[model samples]
Target: MELKVSSRSHGDHTIVTIVGEIDLYTAPRLQSEFTRILDESTTTLMVIDMSGVEFCDSTGMNVLLSAHKRLRERGGVLEMAGPRPAVRKILQVTGLDSVFTIHEAVPEELLAAEPQA
Candidate 1:
């Protein structure tokens, strides 16, 4: 299924909420969204709200890794929030769970303060 992505800015971060299956066919869309957010905004953090994600594959993992790498290069970070069971398992099985910061939800404290541009 095609993925749906919507984003909002929180402090120095951008929270992108994604829904649908994340596979080879749909990963590029997510990648583009990340590229756009990173290029167009003064965001230092990217939070992926994966609560609605029904599935995730290697392609999806690659997309996340790429974003993480890009952000880290700029001294930024990528966080994954509220992933479903299947998606979480994929991350765990691939030993990628340790690679990202996982949250139960968007950290309200992070949203309360916007970093200087």
Candidate 2:
């Protein structure tokens, strides 16, 4: 399946919604989106909405790790929300569940808040 990536700003956070499979062919697209968001947005917090992702491979995981590292280096945070069972298992097996702040869902407060000026 084709990978789809999009983002929206909410308060101090940027919520990136991703769908479809993330693998060798799709990971670059995800990486491109992350690079764009990092370079353009001023927000220090990013929430990755992973509820739509049905499959994610090692390349996809690496892309996520790279984004997380980059965010941390700039004193920002990268959060994962609503990962499906398979992705969640991969994270757990890889020990990345401990590294990332995984959420059951994107926080309601963040979605309801007005974007920061």
For each candidate, what TM-score against the reference? 0.91, 0.95
Score candidate 1 by TM-score against the native. Answer: 0.91
lDDT of 1 by residue, 3-50 (tens): 999998866888899999989899999999999988988888889999
Residue range 13-110, candidate 2, lDDT tens digits: 89999999999999999999999999987879999999999999999999999999998999999999999999999999999999999999998888
In terms of lDDT, the poorest run of 10 residues in model 2 is 108-117
lDDT of each: 0.90, 0.94
Q: What is the C-alpha local distance difference test score of candidate 1?
A: 0.90
Q: Candidate 1, which segments miss by more than 4 Å at Cα?
A: 111-117
Error of 2 at 70 (Å): 0.7
Measured by TM-score, the strongest candidate is: 2
- For residue 92, give model 2's deviation from the true position in Å: 0.5
Alpha-carbon RMSD of each model: 3.1, 2.2
